[model samples]
Target: MKNGIEIMNVEQTFNGKKVLNGINVKIEKGEIFGLLGPSGAGKTTLIKILTGQLKQTEGKAEILGKDARKLTGEDYKKIGIMMDNFGLYERLSCFDNLKLFAKIYEITDDEISGILKEVGLLEAKKALAMNLSKGMRNRLQLARVLMLKPNILFLDEPTSGLDPATVDAIHGLIENERQKGTTIFLTTHNMAEAEKLCDNVALLNEGKIVEYGNPKELCRKYNHQKKIKLHLYDGQNIELEHDKSVAKILNRYFEQGLVETIHSTEPDLELVFMELTGRKLDK
Candidate 1:
């Protein structure tokens, strides 16, 4: 039992149009792996194949050491999914909605309350799902999945269209899940979120993986300029190559107390993605 996900040359097509092409990756147990790409980039298609919702046109996908195509009801019990179409009973109160899943999962009301509180929804427990704000609805959906305590979690665009505070709250919940040793497979087009949450990420574009690696390492690998960006006390900005030849000039600025701030010219995840695919992550 590998206790993680493995995909070997996985490919999917619809009407002879390839949506995923020769995709290959391995996700270790308790790892947070991100599939990042723009719309129509096959991220959702790959997730569906991994979760057994859809069969691949070729190759293999194994989840929790079992073939994805042969996942059983018990296998599904060990998986938690939160996606846009994960419906909520609009007529039901938040507490009731959780209660429904709790019953299915054989959990107690106490557990439901605890998770609700953890997601900052305890005060809105009795509020109808239809009346809750988008953030609250998102939290409730998260609580629903977290309460399952599944070994694997699939989150598709979990923070899309969310406010900063709400996104932060969701990120906190996700971090807590990571601490619990849950293997998370996240699909998102948000580069910043992927950089913050993913231990390793695959940059998908036009049905192929353009790049894959630790987000920070990928950024550093693409940092070609090797320069230092500096701000001076007189509001002057300078970009200088990070070489011994510039050491004297840098020391002079510091000696004169003229340096305000300095930063390395390492590219961020978005920049790295762009440099690799010649396209923006959001586009």
Candidate 2:
């Protein structure tokens, strides 16, 4: 079966300084594949290589089985890209900004309207892009890209600055795309979002893929010191390790009906990433 996007030992360099080092990844058809990393992790460089904006210095990058370098302008009809600070005409209304893109891509108004509704921008269509809130601008950008139902979507930090509600709305739109069989390559530092949305992920460090697997699997693999914390009704708190259940003490509390609350602490994607990279995503 064709991997929607594939890279084999890919490398990128700028001014003789390498940015990506021997990267290898295969994003399956119709799956949301996350590239997780912190700033300066070469995530953007890899995206540029995949989208054919920049050529790799070594190895191969392909979309739909064709070399990235060989992709013609026509090939872009199958791709949608939403990078950070994606431009919108500040002077134009939200609808007008999308209209410009529609005219270039030859997208009909019906599709544009439908996408605006999908991204929850239908009500703000007449508002100037500059007048729209941050969340609204994000929706408008997503709508513009969705005007063409591309087979592959490259989203870079799709929810970086938005509030929780907007983040949820954006992810809902992403899920709809995933359901429609769009292969999404998402690059984000939001580890929780990655774990929640990705079918599989590659944790990228400075230039290399430090880990690759389902997010849950990676987290489980590194959950060596799993712990549980509980507060006792008797005004005492205790921490118990998974491997060493600490049952003798816990059983005493259990028998005495003295447990007030208990919480199990499983390793999350952020902790797992930190374990591999020696730093958190924000840092």
Best by TM-score: 1
| Cα shift from native, residue 37, model 2 (Å) | 0.9
Model 2 TM-score, 2 decimals: 0.90
How many clashing pairs per prediction, in order? Answer: 0, 0
Q: lDDT by residue for model 2 over 18-110, one digit each (tens)?
A: 889999998989999999999999998899889888889999998978898888877888888888756889999977888888898888887
Candidate 1, poorest ten consecutive residues by summed lDDT: 78-87
Least accurate 10 contiguous residues by lDDT in model 2? 241-250
Candidate 1's TM-score reads 0.97
For candidate 1, what is the lDDT?
0.92
lDDT of 1 by residue, 26-62 (tens): 9999999999999999988888898899999999999
What's the C-alpha lDDT at position 186 in model 2? 96
Model 2 alpha-carbon drift over 4 Å, by segment: 1-3, 231-236, 243-262
